[model samples]
Target: MNSNSQAIKLFLVVAFSCTSLLASLTPVLAKPTPNRFDAKTILAQAKTFNQPPIPSGSPPKIRLRGGGKRAFNQPPIPAGSPPGGRVRGGAKRGEPACPTPKIDLTALVPFTQEANSVINVWGQTTVEHPSWFFYVPYTKDSPYTVEFVLQDPDANEVYKKAIALSDKPGVIRVSLPSTTPGLAVDKQYRWFFTINCDKQKNSPPSFVEGVIKRVNLSQPTLKEIETAEPLKRYAIYAQNGIWYEALTTLAELREKNPQDPTLKAEWRNLLSSIRLDDVAEEPILPGTP
Candidate 1:
């Protein structure tokens, strides 16, 4: 090889090595930015955007005016029912009102009970005056035996009697008589009657209250029968086509001589003839003397 060529080659190698070394040692230049962001300002902005710190594990506290307790003692609530139910008012418990008594005439009369003589108006002692007669309608279906009870203002029973009712329909006349010969009248003597009927079919133990009425017997009157008279004698009897002076005359004859069929016929006839109006009519006035 020539000396000039060897020198040229050595120069080229050295130059290439120098150029590679310069390239390796050279610094890299960055591109210029339009706007700059400050670290301090960025840190402040991040702190503002961050979520608030979580609360501690505890319930919030609240203050009340009054203590924590109910105002009233509530009643026990029924299960599956509405609360505080049903406020109402009415009649007190265990109290029953008085019921009005009604009379049933279709039932049967009692034959066993006897009449009381203490309340007899025609007999010695009476409850009412002779002029006035308290009447009970005799029902053909049932014979009712009424017991008369005399009561004072205190509701105490002083006198009572069970009078057998007549079979036929007629007034069971009660004639009131004066207890004293002469005196002013006082409070009305109150007498009530109770009807005792035999145990009837399909009916409860039946009875009636306040059957008889009241009268002031002490009141003065013109008609005074000071003498005792039988109720049958005073009872006006209507028989046949004519009204008779007495009821028991036929009954008396039948009783005295039971062997006679005529007497029985006479009694039946008299009973059939007894008309209500015939007994009600006042006696005819005597002609002017």
Candidate 2:
């Protein structure tokens, strides 16, 4: 062979080898496998966001005597008085709100790990009206009336609804109706959920209450939420401190896919992060009234 021919052959051989090497790695590079979802990692990232501060003192205990109908429009428990006050239970202020002897009621409010029954949810400023979630633990399999009441910062009654729950003990989600008036931006509202156990006496109602505020979301945030994948959207909400939406989205997803172990784990992790491990294992039932 001539020198030039040999040189050309050598160059071709080198080029062919390089091409084969790249071809072998093409699948591994081009079709990269996605990382498995890590509940702890995602939760850690979420904790980096600015969450509302948990109240310092214990919640107040308000024991209901007789069938007296205290006005629902009363001003919220004074800020320095107590964080969350129980209606009847002798538990000190800042204690869990739904400490029913038989059942426990919990609001799906963020930053509640240290809070009593009263939780404060940091919402998006642009969101007019938002939904809320509750974890109700019932010892018996009987029908119970769940009452939801919303009061404005001025303690004015804004919305009220009574839902009849027939499902067995589990976590229930409550979405404010779009038809209802939207929450004003930069405003705080107090919400109360009571499980009317004794209808005839109406003395003590198993109840949980929390405060929610509406804040504005930046355009980039809105875009991210709109474009993010369904599974990842909740994490985004959590990282941004959008409590109501995060809990609601994960819950709705879990309800639709009851058998998804990943969703179940995510749900448990989400609740556990808030110190609600007790009710974390409860089933996510379909349809909330």
Candidate 3:
């Protein structure tokens, strides 16, 4: 073959070899890696945990509760009310005087539907001492008495804690203390977050309650969680149907790294997944014991 023809043949071979090599590596190099925790992919993987759907077996364990009025000590709903019974909503925190910040007290929880009459939401956790989060619009300038209560399935009280919000308006967390009894596995416990808006003597306070069950993590799932980095630990939890852990981990991460845009985007995506878009933008405060 002439020198020119030989050079042309060699160039063709080199080009074809490189193309084949790239084709072989496409899946490994270009495919999305689990550790990436991209907003779309991580949130899409979140389908594995769809905000703890409204369960079918029993009536909703969570509800707006307290004595209906100043004199009533019992829950407002009569005994044996229907499946979707109306629970009592305590006094509303009237419009405060200064600059009007967010006026509603909100729980950082997954809800089946929103209303003062009823609340239907349940989140699962693998840990015994799980932390509950909320957005408290009332600052020290416009404070409210907040209390946390945990109850057994029989409507009996388990642990009662009082929270003091002495800071600015923002999100706050209430952690089940080590002194309190750790949650029993597979048993649903009811918890109430109450804000006494008026602080009236013998008056019922505004409260929202939810049911949380502790479950044993599978061996393989536990291994995955132990090895996951901070960027993906929350995603791992969410993929396995652990709602409290998923939300808490991500919220803690976002609180610690406030300036990271990637974390912010991931936070928004996670909250928006379950229709909790309203309280997504509130600032997270340092949690209490």
Candidate 4:
């Protein structure tokens, strides 16, 4: 072969080899899309609250965590009312003005067809201390009261407490105290968080409600949860479709590690997956005990 022809051939061979090597490495070098906590994915992998063989087939054992205190002298709802029913009335004349109508006061529940603006949560729990979360808009330190009411499937009030809101506006979590009665297995309970913008009003328009049904976790899932690292536990909960526990775990983690970029990103992604981007960027403020 001529010298020039040989030189051209060598260059072409080297170029072809480099191109082939690059093509081979592309998949390895490409970044995998970050895992997002999608509700559908959770539903597929995790057992639903409605599943049989309920966990701890008894009432949830309540354990006081020294934060949420029960309200005293709160009147019980009259008997024969609908389950998850609330008394309705306009705000009384003299109370902290209601939040701007534009404010999106929402319950941080799963994005399901069953969930509406009224705030409906789902999933199962084995713990007596299940916490609920809400996205309260920035009211510049405006004081608010969150009245938590728990009712059985028949709508009879089982437990109710009105917690005072002292934290800055953001995502706030209210945990039920251990003193409260435990939730029975395989039974659905409805809860409400009424933001008493005006105490005088019988029922403020700004309120949320959700349903929770406790179920037993599979043996393998429980084992995995027991062995999973603290940070990884949220993923486990999410994968199992335990909405309350997963959100609570991640929220607690973010509260402790406010500056952690990874946790923050995970929080954002999780919330965004449910179309809660409006309050996704809101900081996880220190909630009132």
Candidate 1, number of clashes: 4
* Residue ranges of candidate 1 with Cα displaced over 4 Å: 1-134, 139-144, 175-185, 198-289
Evaluated against the true structure, the overall lDDT of model 4 is 0.61
Question: How many residue pairs clash (N, CA or C atoms closer than 3 angstroms) in each of the candidate models, in the order given?
Answer: 4, 14, 0, 5
The segments of candidate 4 whose C-alpha lies over 4 angstroms from its true place after superposition are: 1-97, 114-121, 138-145
All candidates: TM-score: 0.25, 0.62, 0.64, 0.61
Distance from true position, residue 38, model 4, in Å? 30
| lDDT score, candidate 4, position 219 | 94
lDDT of 1 at 202: 24
Residues 1-289, candidate 3, lDDT per residue (tens digit)? 9999999999999999999999999999999766767788778767645444444333233211122210101112212322231122234454323233444666666555333334555677899899888777666655567788988767788889878875787778888888878899978778877767555535556666667778888998899789988756776676666778877888888878998887776666656555566566777776545
In order, what lDDT does every prediction score?
Answer: 0.31, 0.62, 0.65, 0.61
Off by over 4 Å in 2: 1-103, 112-126, 139-144
lDDT of 2 by residue, 1-289 (tens): 9999999999999999999999999998999677555788667666643233345443222111112221011122334323343322222323433335543676655443234435333223246667777766663454456688988878999889876674476677676788888898867777888775554623455676766777666888889889988766776666555667777788888888988988887777666555456677877766775
* 2 or 4, greater by TM-score: 2
- The per-prediction CA RMSD against the true structure, in angstroms, equals 44.2, 16.9, 16.0, 13.9
Positional deviation of 114 in candidate 3, in angstroms?
A: 11
Candidate 4, pairs of clashing residues: 55-216, 67-289, 83-155, 119-209, 121-210
Residue pairs with backbone overlap in model 3: none
Per-residue lDDT for 162-215 in model 4, tens only?
666644566777777888787787677888776666556554446666677766
How close to the true structure is residue 242 of candidate 2, measured as C-alpha lDDT?
Answer: 63
Give the Cα-based TM-score of candidate 4 against the true structure: 0.61
